[model samples]
Target: MRRGGDWKRGTVERPVGAPVFDPTDERGEETERATSASPRLSSTLLQRGKSDAADAEAICEAASRPKLRKNFVPIKSPEQQGAQMLARVRNQFIGRRTQLANSIRGYAAEFSFTAPRGLSRLQQLLIDIRDDTTVPNLAKELVEALAIELARVHDQIAKLDKKLMQLHRSNEMSRRLAAIPGVGPIGATLLSIKVVDARGFKSARNFAAWLGLTPKNHSTAGKNRLGVITRAGDGMLRTVLVAGATAVIADMRRRGSRPWSWLKDMIARKPPKLVAIALANKLARIAWKLMVSGERYRPASAVPMPTPT
Candidate 1:
């Protein structure tokens, strides 16, 4: 089934008693692009009685539809899949490191040892735990174990970071994407690999919407209501984009000069988090344009230079 049309959109069927669900649902294990049941192509076919033949027929029915052409996901090469695996492993290691650090912090706090926030402060707390005579020896040993595990995780993450950076340096498209203000090596590389075919998206807005950066639609007759982001795509990708945007805004604030007038005005009027999401959405759209048009980023004109005093 995979050989001729693995990328084709098709229907998913579960046991007869099971309730139907969207294959592209955000809560599914990983994003639906690779592991999808091929929903949008045929989510509306909820025929309940499901045998293997019935499922195949349903899939065939969906694939036969002309509209399914618009809904297909890109078929990733082996190289792209490998890059995704690396990103995922690195993400897992980073998360484990955070978990270990938090556990160490909580344990040390119980024994009246504390350090200010920040991962760097964790090492100092670990040293304090090792040297403290008043704390129970058993607890000290346990905390030391956690600290050691955390250090190992940190080293692994560093290794993965180095490898990902090398990949970024080697890819022309990734390098082009890195030119965006918020997107760095990691973000650029991720976008490059995950979105292998830019034309799969209808437009830049569609690309941003696919990433779930857009507001949820709650429109009624003669009225418009927007809610939080749909948050409907690969969670990691969205997180990377948002984090990059936050760093950009933070730096702009620290330096006391907005790079663009619209950003300055928005920051003045909107909440910082909301501004970050907006900026992230813009970044996704810009990335899509770069991928689709094969054009390098052309930054918008900056705030006018101050006249010489």
Candidate 2:
């Protein structure tokens, strides 16, 4: 069937035991929209025509080709769906909160009341503005309202954090995944829920490529060329992984933590943001290995302390 509004509703109402196939076009864009049903089928057949009936016929014709059915997207369980929803909601609130904070900062700048960086500093600035006699009453009231909204978003995010933490504790796989240096409760839980079976990927590199962490290859003849990441898969997952990598790099730089000597040298030579992307690619490979092998990470010993001269 052509997967659309009414069709989607009907597909969701199908018997739980029945087999359902979701077909993606050549671009592979509709994969995630099929959270309930699967295995996914890829075919150029669906692109034959834009009409609903033509699309339905194309799906039927595509189903007949055994070669086209080789690639299938795995079906996600209800639990995983719940976790994805929670993550999406939390992400939405984070964006809104940032917008409100920026608005507060922008408006205050017009009055030459520049606040220090960071959320705490912004909140404090709002309080000071509220009490200052020189500030206009209308401006004070507007800024106060923004502060209240920002506080509300903060409270909601905290509630989601508690929920994610509970899920992280309950799931053995997520807890095991949290053993990785940069991975926290949110990243662990998201990975567990998003990737049902890392073993399905043929190799660690394939898994990293699937996450779009690997560089794009454009090779012809004997010469080979590479470009930036494809940015083609699970954008939210990729974003969080990069964010975790950033945090790890920042902490290591500040504390001079004893990471591998090669990594230290790379950090010194490369731009920090580029290093973070590279680290995130390595982290993806490590997570794939751990997931496939069913082993928790074991940290290497810290660099040997120097002996007294």
Q: Quick one: best lDDT, which candidate? A: 1
Choose the strongest candidate by TM-score: 1
> Taking the tens digit of each residue's C-alpha lDDT, what string does model 2 give over 1-309?
344432332222124455434445566555434423222342356565467576556555555565543234465556666777898898999999999999999998888778877888996778778878989999989998998899999999999999989989999989988988788778898898788678778888888788888888899898899888888667888898899999988898799776556567778898887888888887888888888988877765312223333
TM-score of each: 0.84, 0.78
Model 2 spans > 4 angstroms off: 1-48, 56-72, 301-309
TM-score of 2: 0.78
Tens digit of per-residue lDDT, candidate 1, span 1-309: 233323334334333333322223333332333322355444466478757675666666776676665455555656777888798898999999999989998988898989999999988888888888898889988887888888899999999999999899999999999998889889999888777688888899988988999999899997999999999877888999999999999998899764566677788999999999999998898898889888888764212433333
lDDT value, residue 270 of candidate 1: 97
Q: What TM-score would you give candidate 1 relative to the actual structure?
A: 0.84
Error of 1 at 230 (Å): 0.5
Q: lDDT value for candidate 2?
A: 0.75
Regions of candidate 1 where Cα sits further than 4 Å from its true position? 1-44, 64-71, 301-309
